[model samples]
Target chain A: MDLVFFKIALALYLGASAGYLVFLLISSESRASVGFWCAVMGFVAHTLSIMHRAIFSGFFPLATSFDALSAFAWLLVGIFLLVRYHDPSPIFGSIVTPMASVLMIFGWTLVYQVTEPLIPVLRSTWLPVHVTLALAGNGVFAFMAIGGLMYLFQERLIKTKRLGRLHRLLPSLATLDTINRHGLPFGFFLLTLGIITGAFWASSVWGSYWTWDPKETWTLITWFVYAGMIHQRMVLGWRGKRAAVLAIIGFGLVMFSFVGVNALLGGHHAFQGANRFMPPSGL
Target chain B: MEIMVIGLNHSTAPVEIRERITFPGDHDGAVARMIGDVEGVEEAIVLSTCNRAEIVVTTKDVEESRERLIRTIGEIHGQDPSVFRSYLYVRHGADAVRHVFRVAASLDSMVLGEPQILGQVKEGYRRATKARTTGPILNRLMHRAFFTAKRVRTETGVGSAAVSVAYVAVELARKILGELRDKSILLVGAGEMAELAARHLNNQVDRPIVVVNRTYENACILAEELQGLPIRMEQLEQRLVQTDVVITSTGSCDPIIGKAMMKRVMRARRHCPIFLIDIAIPRDVEPDANEIDGVYLYNIDDLQAVVAENIGERRKEALSGERIVSEETEKFMHWTKTLDAAPTIVALKEKLEHIRATELARLNGKFADLDPAQREALESVTRQIINKIAHDPIVFLKRTGAHGKQNLYLDAVQRIFRLNGAADNQNEGEEL
Candidate 1:
């Protein structure tokens, strides 16, 4: 049933992504409503799938890379759809739903689906809290980066003097900039909390609060990059292309922290028990 | 009655001729009265904007109304009617309704999509109303024009983009900065285009404008005129961090704001986005200055290109506006047809009832042998049979009437039904 729900969600996301693409091309406001409802339905099915996984596994579904990415994608969709509800702009879906779809596809293709027994490090009560906050932080950055990309696209169109259909379809530079500003501080704060909570959990389990493990180091680096972005925004009121660039860079760092450290630079965070370049294989 | 529009717009007449044909504000009601006094004209409205002078009217005779409108307009402007006749373009029936819709939608303005024409039309309607020259047909047409204008405004981006370079600058600033309510503008030197941009910003942005020029005295003079604070050119570096938008039109030999100086300002401002409009010949701000983070620099060519692109987009949107005009014209024409159909349907029913009453009265004595209930049943059965026979012709007349062949269809229905006096009554009601 969980897999069935997941499949349905994946299909819906794919359809919604195409709808948004059409909306972007033609700049049709009514088609945006179609895309929005598709996202909403996909989100509902995605939630049911995640809930089913957690219930059957007797834990949150952050045990494997596939589980982590799928859950993160779900959260990202939730955040995006909620924001769009408050502000009805389909332009975000043009970028975000595709990103969600890609993440889900990657989860299915590259990561193992089987739930493994928890290691001593992952068995503590603090595990769920640390992982949830950490994943939530990445989810926020994902949305912010999408908004940043739209800002860059719109700014380029304006700068190049091409006020065409796509240009009109985009949200105003101010609106995109506003989203970046609000997202930066909120994502930064959550990332800070995640880092702090992880440190506490690590100290309790490993007898040290600070570790130079590759995953921890990269996550910290991701946190600092976002911290810098927030500082530049709040103290300097810095925004526009610069802020957008920083956001995209920060999200790239987040990707590296989530995937690169596990796959390329194995550390205590590795789930398959060793650093391997090959995809994890299991039902 | 027929709807007609007879006038000369910017496309049809020279500026001198258009200016001569306008109704002065003091004599706003005079032109309506003059057009209303013409024979065959039932209602008249005179809309005299800077680019066009139009006389919209409803009349019994379309050709006669057009001639009288041209003659009266010529007489009022102290020109020969023949001199103006060549410049006038006339539209009647459905074309006239479409013309009014397009004009109200700003599709017919000298600058397409300019919003003032809608307001001008509404003012014309007001003047016509006050003059008591607008009857039911004109009133309904004007209301639909207003609704069509609103629909065009919302359904398309027809009147949304800025067409002028100065307005484009303001539009870009608002796009980048979101709102200018608390933002500040720095006017670096002064030029006509730069001043126009500043004025446009001042109207929408509730912020104090700062003027800086190489000559302190000139800066002070412009500052006083614009109700802004004046600063010397040397102080530009000191005040650069506070400015959100900088319009530089200085006659400088080289760049005034270099990339290095902009970098320092960005660092101080913590990278708040600043839009720089360089309307200068040699460029007051270095082109490389725009490459920095949070700095957007648009020169005159860039701004003009943006305006050009927006105009193209507006033209594309105007296609949709034209479709809306056609749709509304069809709808309004159908409504007028229904107006004609209403009285015809009434006349047809009355004619059928008249025959039924005369025949029933003649049969009353013949059916007197039956009881009262039986007699009533017979009467109702005969009545239903007559109604059934009349239904098909009545429906056909209404359907055809709504398509504007009502006179032909009504005449045929009356002659076939042998209804006397009803057709004449319908024609009289239509003329009124």
Candidate 2:
């Protein structure tokens, strides 16, 4: 996580995303190689960046909601890029890169604002541990979210009989279906542990175990939505479009839960218990 | 150099014939044994997949190698070597290189630049490696073939479109029906292409596939392979009524799917679209059946039109790929040549060193007035001068003699150096 490595990673991420888009238009395999190595370099950089942050400060770097989101976004993008690199089945930056670009933008613009949260809660030992786990869980969920959304998009094209160029680029329904099944459950398990830890930490600090806080409530809702998606897909022999649609909906809920709960809704955990990054109009 | 390709392609033989000639899975050991039995075959590998079975062998005697290969494989399948040889085509040197590149890139495949050929080549390389059948020559060749395939994909748009008929059928089905899993695929006349199309559907769709052919056993074979059910031709109408897609590649002389017959099936299905693929030479479905409502009819002409379009793209891309291959091939050859010349360059340097040592040893006493340290310094200077003199010849011999002339050049250089008279005697006596 040297500053040089971090800078190099950011450069690689930018290059890879651009390169993949170029290849998509030209339909060239040479750029795929460029795209793949760029991703590898970017992944190395992202990992180092996190490690640097961790070593510089005796904290997990997810001290605030913004820091948490950025790390989570990076984790999700890294995994997606690696999977596409190994599979080489045309699932590239089309889905994952845009998501990474947005998260990085948000990470840079917003996270720096909360550098001086003069509160004991922000300084608590449990804050880093709980938030780190939560963000990591969120990262896993986001991966599932993107994959599920792509699955949904592909299924829609197939259902409509359009058979566009995109259909040719995307993976088979069977592959998409399996990816969703494999990813979402792991995401759910992480989120459950994350929520439980958060509840315990809240009880210790705020003298309450069950608060109808926006973040907690939204997380609960996201959990239920995913739970329902998994149920439909596994038990009902539901596959492809119907299953993909549900995944998309669940991920949409997760997205809303992620930003809306922080930006608009008020809670003890909201904005990492700091008002500097929060706008004047508080939720 | 010998180059031989044994077994059948789509044009030279049918699926039944190719299947008979094709080896079982992971047969590199068997193939290697066969190649070992062939006189003068230095290396061999077998590329086996659904479309083709090709045996690539490298040897000094092309005619004998070809004969042995044909005889062995023919005997394996109880055929005369001459009969099988007539069905096989042999190419040597650059033609062999081009053929393998084309095959690995799917350009030489029946389906024309299909994606599966790359995977098949990988499997072939893997199996050959395991069996130790592939030596350095074919090892380099297969590896280059992969690069050629990659070059074809990157430099050309040949692989941009779905050229394979199986994929084309899937594309057409996707365009017409949308999400094949919800719709049933009724396969008639267990023709290889039709069965391949069905297999593609089976992987893509969730809907139960029903294959009804005239031969129940052929239908069963296709069904077992794809996890589909084999229904008798008697049940064709009943199944056709409910099915969304129908591919017919039967050997019927007259139309099995007559206009009146399809009309009743369409009515029974409540006007759902029924796709008919007439893959047979004389055509299986009637020409009039295409006129019916919600019926999409395509005979061999339509299939060929798609093939023509794919070929059009391939022809354009083939030129670009060939350019890339030409450049890459030269680059690889240059690398190999440089490596080959390295040993000669080393040996030539050693010979020069030996000459310099002998002359220095013989002449050292003439400069007796010099101190020991001064003599040592002179020795160092002589060695440096010898190195400077030897550099250009080493480069020349390495570059020019890298291929076939290196041995002759090295021998000539050794004679000029009197290397045999001095170095050989000195080395043997030094050891003693």
Which number leads on DockQ? 1
Report the lDDT of model 1 for residue B372.
Answer: 85
Per-model TM against the reference = 0.76, 0.59
- Taking chain B only, the TM-score of every model is 0.81, 0.54
CAPRI grade, predicted model 1: acceptable
lDDT of 2 by residue, B76-168 (tens): 667666655666767776677777877877677665556888998888878878887776557667777787787687666777666667777
For A86-148, candidate 1 gives per-residue lDDT tens digits of 777677787778888999999888875665555455677777888888888888888788888
DockQ, cand. 2: 0.10
Q: In model 1, what lDDT does residue A265 have?
A: 78
Among the numbered candidates, top lDDT falls to 1
- Alpha-carbon error at B315 in model 2, in Å? 3.8
Clashing pairs in 1: A236-B270, A238-B271
TM-score of candidate 2 relative to the true fold = 0.59
Give the residue spans of candidate 1 off by over 4 A: A1-16, A40-71, A85-90, A105-131, A154-178, A195-218, A227-242, A259-283, B23-39, B42-46, B72-80, B122-156, B267-270, B327-432
Q: lDDT of all predictions, in order shown?
A: 0.81, 0.68
Candidate 2: lDDT of A33?
67
